[model samples]
Target: MKVSFDPDVAMLLRRVAPAGVVWVLLALPSQSVYADDYPCRVALCVPSPTNPWSIAACVPALERLFDDLAHGRGWPTCEGSGVSMNYVNTPFDPCQGGLNEAGPGAWVIEGKKQPNHPTWFYTDPASYGISPSASPQQSAGGDAVANASLACVGKLMGTYRTYVGQYNRDYQEVNVAVYDQIVWQKPQSPWAIDVYQNGQFSRRVHWK
Candidate 1:
């Protein structure tokens, strides 16, 4: 899972500005080559809080998390690898949004959609065996996006934590207890998501 960066890509990484740099790095000619090698597409649903600025602020962290998952774990494998990651804004509460709004618990892989599934990389302490009342430490001003992104990454990687907060009520709990349980369906329908949680397996359910 050690991805080797081409010389040009390495140079670009060092010189590019930090804001939204992940997109630029991933768009390099080398990455296109990698895509050609793998030949599959992936779309990720990143959390988008109510604050408008939060999405822009969190873009870097989201990109990094996406890259880590894509490269570190060899996800969307050669059999399923056109490799496109889309970041959709989702409200914190699943019940708050209208049909047009990207509410919580939405999921999409490739082109297929699973409207009832929790957003990919989303976390709720209670679902991971932590107390329902424990809250995450509040991030200081300007650091909120970074901290949020880190938490998402940690949860996606199966790093359990204990935290209590009022917002816990807003998050929809997903049963994915570990990262490995997130699986792609067979090659016949590679875009399908198959999840194993709490001793039960759930297949890719069409968006309602």
Candidate 2:
């Protein structure tokens, strides 16, 4: 579903747009636009001391991953702790905080920073698979937001690193301006998130 505002409407929006507002034009996949059976809201849980979109501010690589996942396309490689689908059958509560434990593996999000990079952040979508065009500023902002969100979730989930660090966690910072650039970019659609885990791929997490 390619969603575009008519030029006239766009002009009108721009004229009346609030300060700091940016308009985006997107050509999104149909699966992203349509509803689905997966009631559980899923987020990409890249634990391993790392963390990793929508409207939802998203990039081409992210969008592509969602599209590919919906169509039975292959998995995108992940580094460090690898990715997992932390699912919450109900909305809010667990989904906003973190996923619950399941089975023997103790499905929890936990990790310490990888040895090579202490101040590491997961921002490179290309490393996973596709490297869509993105400016340095856009990438940096996205990385900041991703790291912040990860740390926030990690702290909430009672992770050792986040708890011990005494870092001032602000979940609100997850939506800071720096990260907004990634989603506000033009020409791409962002509907959901996909992650490869447990020797198989998780379902496409439809946009809320």
Q: Which lDDT values do the candidates have, in the order given?
A: 0.30, 0.30
- Total clashes, candidate 2? 2
The per-prediction CA RMSD against the true structure, in angstroms, equals 19.5, 20.0
Best by TM-score: 2
Q: Model 1 misses residue 61 by how many Å?
A: 0.3
- The window of 10 residues in a row where model 1 has the poorest summed lDDT is 146-155
Q: Candidate 2 — worst ten consecutive residues by lDDT sum?
A: 173-182
Clashes of each: 14, 2
Q: Candidate 2 at residue 78, lDDT?
A: 31
User: Residue by residue across 43-151, what tens digits does model 2's lDDT show?
Assistant: 2222111222322223344455556667877555433223454322321111223422121211123222333533234323332222244212212122233312211
- Using all chains and alpha carbons, the TM-scores for the candidates as numbered come to 0.16, 0.22
Writing each residue's lDDT as its tens digit, candidate 1 over 1-208 gives 4455544434434432233424332443365553443211122112111221133323343344445554665344322212233222322211111212111222311112224555553344434444444333321123233212111111232333332324646343323223312222211212223322222432221111
Model 1: how far residue 128 lies from native, Å: 48
